[model samples]
Target: MTACGYRVGGQGASLPTEIKVIAVPAFENRTPWMRLEQRLTAAVMQEFIHRSRYRVVGKEQDADAVLRGAVTSATTTPVIFAPETGRASAVQVAVRVSVELRDRRTRATLYANRDFVFREQYEISSDLDSFFEERDPALDRLARDFAASLVSAVLENF
Candidate 1:
């Protein structure tokens, strides 16, 4: 005889069940990148809205908890080079971010990650006339990924 059972995959919510609302204000940008904070903030808020049932807000006073994020640093390094021109053809953009989630009433930190780093590679356009800024697209993707990761970390209390 054999016994069979089913199990769930996720660890489930680790924070207090009383926290039903969260405020995600614009993240601070310590780096030189322009408007990077806005991108990160918007992405994180959107992720929370899409994935969780919590009521997300922009003002801390309107929510039970608040999530604060900051872009610590950003740099782009050449990863691939062009054969003929000997110029950089691809770059790896690395960004460091710090985040914290705290209860508004108690001011207790629910989650904190001081130095979370993420990197992505973007190819440079070969045609100079058609060249466009790749940083924006890369940053957008990075922000989305960071948001998903941040939400997961908070939910898992990691």
Candidate 2:
């Protein structure tokens, strides 16, 4: 039992204890976005390093398990429009990602999600001079959120 005197799900719940090290490679970008995969991969690696007990490696040969990511689709849509010019005042970006984790020695699949999707909206600039490209920043935000959620999934064995 936990300090609260009640177990949440199971005793000592987590990924396999043997998985002491993890490797994360550059995500495969199936979409048109040039380096979105790199950003996402980097974010996930950073999250694991900061939040998990396992040692993270950049190469699969150095890890006990491997976490693979692939970006499937990305799209943008205008959510809010300027009343005067009919121009987009806000836009939403939707991204679909596939992720998998497997033990290197046993070759057993630990976790896999083929259709994970995340969407975020950012305000567009209607005023001139105030606009300075926000899609990149918005994507960074999305990557961070995705990484956190991914880490949680692994930690909980979800």
Q: State residue 71's C-alpha deviation in candidate 1, in Å.
A: 1.0
List model 2 lDDT by residue over 1-158, tens digit each: 44764545322156788888999988999999989998889999998888877898989999999999899998889999998999999888888899899999999989898987878788878766666576577778878987887777766777
Q: Write the per-residue lDDT of candidate 1 for residues 94-124, one digit (tens) a residue.
A: 8888999999989999999998787878787
TM-score of 1: 0.86
- Candidate 2 lDDT (Cα, whole model)? 0.84
lDDT, residue 154, model 1 = 78
Q: Candidate 2 clashing pairs?
A: none
